[model samples]
Target: MAGVVKTGILGLDAMLNGGIPEKNQIVLAGGPGAGKTLLSFEFLYRNAKQGNNSVMFVVEEEAEKVLENAKGAFSGLKDIDDLVKNGSLSVEGLSAVSNASESMRQSSYEFGNFISDIEAIIADKKATRVVIDSTAVLEILVKDPLMFRKSMLALVVDLRRLGVTSILTAEMSSLEKQSLSFRPEFFLFDGIIMLYLSGEEEKRMQSMEIIKMRGSKHSFVTTPYDISPAGFKVFAAEEITQE
Candidate 1:
C-alpha cells in the first residue's frame, strides 16, 4: 500500500500482487474493440476516486469525446464529470502533427514539444497517475522506425523520472495478436498486459493476460473478463483455456 500504485480495478489489483510498483510504466496491448480505452480510463477513474490525481493524454481523438463515451458507457460512474471539474481527473489531447512548427513536424526526431506539453500538464495537476490513449498515433507522427523507438524510449524515461505510474495503450488488429506489431519500445517499460478477444464471432469473449511485471509476481494464466454497465469485471481466479 505504501509503495504500490493501486489501479483500484478489483481483480486487476489482486493480479498485480497489490498494485503496480510506484513509477512503473505499464503498457496495455490489445486489438480493436478490446475495451482498452475504457480499461485505461477506469484505472484513472478508480484511482481518482480514492484521491490520487490522475491525467489522461489523448494522442489522436478529441478529449471531450473520450469523456462523453466513458460517461455513456459506464452508467454507474456518475461522478466522472465531478472528478474532471474538481481537478482530480484530467483528460487532455496532444497532437504533434497539428500544432507543432513546420520544422518539428517535418523532422522525425523533434518530439520535444509533445513531451513538454505532457510534463506541463502533469506538473500542473500534481498527478500521480497518467495514461496515453494509444502509442500508434505517435508512431504515425514519426515515420522513421528507429527515431520512433528512440523518441518512445525518451518519453518513457521522462515519465519515470517524473515519478508517476502510467499506462500506455497500444493498438492491435483483432484476434490472436495477428495485427499491430509493436516496436522494441516495449522493453523500456516495466510491465505488459495483453487484452484481446477470443472465440468465434458468435461466442467471442474478452480476456486479459499479464505478460510480465518487473517487481512483482503476476498471474500468467489468460483470464476472462467482460465489460458491464458497472465497469470491467475480471475473473482472475479462473483461467480460460484457449482453443
Candidate 2:
C-alpha cells in the first residue's frame, strides 16, 4: 500500500522519490533508440514480479519481436516471457504496416476496438500497470488532429476507468526544443517524462527529466541514463574535473 508500483530502474525510483503514481497516465518521450521502449518494458516486467499484473501494447512493433528485444535488454526478462507463456502477463503489438493493411482506413471504431482489446487484456490479466510503446504512430493512423485527439481521449479515459497506472512512450524530435508531433496526447495524460539527448555530434548523451507530474514532487534536473543487459539505469551526469 505504501509503494504504489516501483519501476525497479536503478536510481530512477530514487530520483522520483518513490515511483509513478497509481491510476495515472505518464508519458515517456524520447527519440529512436533513446531507451523509451526499454524503460516501459522494464517497468511492466518489474511489476509482474511484484505480484502486480502488467500489460503492454505496442503500436509500431510486432509482439514477438518486442518480447525478443526485451529479452536481450534484461536477462531477468526471461521471467517476462514465462509470464506470457503462463498467461500471467498480456502483450500486444499493432504495427503500422499490419494495422494499416488490415483496416485500410483509420476509423474511431477501429481505435475503439483497440482500446476494447486492451481493456479485455487488463481485466483478464488483472493488470495494474500498462504501457503503450510509442503513441507517435497515432499521427499516421489518424490523419485529422481532432480525430486523433478524440481517439486518444477515449483510450485514455477507458484506461483510467480500468484503474491502471499507464505509461505511454512517445517519440520526440531530434531538435533541441520540444516538437508538437503528437501534442494532443500530452494533454490527456497526468504526467510527462522527457528523455533528452544532448551534446554535439560525437559526444551526445542521454538524460531524463520529469517534465510534468501532476500532484507529485518530481525531479527537475536532467539526469543521465543508459540501457544495459539489466535494463535502464539513470545516473547524475558527472562533472569533468580538470586540474
Backbone clash pairs for candidate 2 read none
**What is the TM-score (0 to 1) of candidate 2?**
0.85
Candidate 2 lDDT, 83-183, residue by residue in tens = 77766566776643235435624353366666777777678778889998877766676778888889989988998888889998888776343552446
Q: All candidates' lDDT scores? A: 0.83, 0.75
Give the 10-residue window scoring lowest on summed lDDT in candidate 2: 96-105
Clash pairs for candidate 1: none
Using lDDT as the measure, which candidate wins? 1
In candidate 1, what residue range of length 10 has the lowest lDDT sum?
Answer: 95-104
Q: 1-243 in candidate 1: lDDT tens per residue?
A: 338888888688777777888889999999888988999999999999999999998876878888898888899888899999999998886443235434444664357777877888899899999999888877877778898889898899999989999999998765574554554888998999889787788799888888888888777777788887788888877343322
**What's the true lDDT of residue 122 in model 1?**
90
Clashes of 2: 0
